[model samples]
Target: MSLRWRITLAIALVSTLVALALSLTVHFAYAYRQAEQARQLQTQRLELALEEYDRTGQPGLRSQLNDPKLPDRLREAASEGGTAAMVTQTPQGAVVWAALSTTGGDTLSLRSSYQPQLDDRASLDRVLLMGAAALIATGTGAGVVIGARLSRRLRHAAAAAARVADGDYSTRVSAAVGGRSRDEAAELAQAVDAMSSALQNRLQAERQVTADIAHELRTPLTGLTTAAELLPEGRSTELVRGRIAVLRDLVEDVLEVARLDTATELPELSDIAVGDFVTRRVATYSSEPEVRVATETVVATDPRRLERVLANLVSNAYNHGRPPVVVEVDGPRVRVRDHGPGFPDEVLAEGPGRFRKGSGGGHGLGLTIAVGQARVLGARLSFTNADADGGAVAVLELPVSEGEDAPGR
Candidate 1:
């Protein structure tokens, strides 16, 4: 059940228990008081009967002389020259009896019908039941109101947290103005806002450091590249050129990551067919991958960014995975699969991190760049191992514009 319903039911259960306890108490108390009053009235009638019998040698009207139906306990008490009263339940109803010993050695007994008191008690019970029902109903309604308010506040906090997770650092949760006293929901909202602020600052600092380092190296890197290019043609010189190229590429990847982190690279959205785009990009690779088009689907996205993402995936697959790489385009979804060892457990779990290379080594920035570019293009990219084929697959799903017909629609 949702938190709202749970809270509502909890309040309703408490209300039910309280109402039941109160109803029982009032029912028993009222019955006891009525019994007591009946006993008192019976005792008064017995006293008057005894007075009349002593003066006129005859019991008063409606009073019995040595009544056989009198309770044994009352009769025994009267025989001992003591007055006693008791209310006993009979087949008819409750009967309150009073008895005493007269001068003639006769037991004087009087009783009053308790049916009226019982009737009143029944009426009371009905009222109490109705009142308890009303109380519970009112409590349930109040619970619904309280639960809705709490649920709404919690939803606001959750939404803000989601936005923060999605890299919207400006999103913050705050309690509503004139809301109820500072509660847990308010505390949660405040905590989310604080966490977002801290995370935003930390990410900004990391991006700044990455950008600064990349900028500082770029000048020396250009000079070195120019000088290396001028250094003849030999195996040793080729090796030097290869190492320099790798270093330059690493610097460029870092710069790209910094730009992505700072959200400075925005997508230039345009209509593109997924099949054609994948085929064209795959042709540009050093070792061309097999391209398969299941259905030609068009999507609105940044073709340049999408190509960059696809390039990284294809490159990563070639460098780290066994050939022959395959790129499949199905509707707006593109899947690049390489027949090699799947991604590492950590990579699959927490995604690719910069400088964190896998078993088959590369700078590890390929997948990271792909993920960043996918995010900029508002696309969903996921990495997984093919269950049957036992190879790594990177899937990128680009969002189609609204009102546009899907493939085969």
Candidate 2:
């Protein structure tokens, strides 16, 4: 049975049992009290009979056989369940007097030769049984009502939670006065709602990212193919090589993003000095690289991911910015600044989104790849066009793991 029915049935059964026990106890008590009263009446009748017999000296006193008052007393005693019987004892033996009782469900035998019987009230007892049953029925009905309310509220909450699980984060249970608020159902609903909102935000972000990826990938692919076709018969060495390099960069950018997106390449993070890594990347850059730092730091990070992150940023700046790019390391992050015409209003507004770039003529995959890599590496990436001049800045933050100390100034 459903929880509601089970709960109702349990309550009803318990109530019935309690009522049955109580009714039986009351019935027994009444029976005992009535028996006591009957016994008292018999005793009083015997006392009165002895008194009259003493006054009249009636050893064989049958009240003159027709004394109406004596016979009437005997009849009254019989009616009251006294079962009046006389037994004569002659030192040899005594005759038996019959048993008597006010009510009878079982027969009683007495020492005297007489018997009295009065039927017990089965109808009154049946009425009490019916009354107890009626009370149980009423209690059961009340239990059913309560269980129904509880089950209804529970069902409502369950439905709402299911909807949220199916991605409808806007789902909410109606908070009536009698709701699942008294149990885990309320907490479950709240959790579902929260999960739905989070899912919505993530889906939206992924959609935007997908659209940007398409746009960004199209550029380098098209440019690389065009550059190949444009080769006027056995392309010049320099032109062919430059086009090939561009193609390589484009392919690497896509691969980098794919790996990060799928988490195929996990960050093998470990303790590494931030200054040393940045310095190495700066040295690798052919263009004049400027480095600035207010603090030197060590952070837990995948060195490979760290290197890739720095490479993407430096490459993006090199391609789009003027010479003498300024890279700075402070706190838990590194920032690369390009002293060139910074990003356009659209690119700046889009933040770290895909298909977004500075004045770089190639695909916008560089920054896109950067963002994906940072995500896989469990870091943060952001970009802003410079307000001071024509410089654009890219910020990459590495989250500090437990037991890692802060930057040392």
Predicted candidate 1: what Cα RMSD to the true structure? 1.8
By TM-score, who's the top model here?
A: 1
TM-score of each: 0.95, 0.45
Candidate lDDT (C-alpha), each: 0.87, 0.66
lDDT of 1 at 150: 86
lDDT of 2 by residue, 152-221 (tens): 8778877776775544556665442234345665665566566667877787577557547745777777
Give candidate 2 regions above 4 Å deviation: 1-237, 263-265
Model 1 agreement with the true structure over 1-409: per-residue lDDT tens digits: 8888988999999999999999999999998898887878788878988888889998895889988899999899889987888889999778888999988788999977878888999999999999999999999999999998888878777877887788877776774312766877777778778878888888888889989999999999999999998999999999999999999999999999999987667888888888988898788777999999988987888988998999889888988899989999889989999999888888899998888887777788999999999989989999999898788999998888787647776
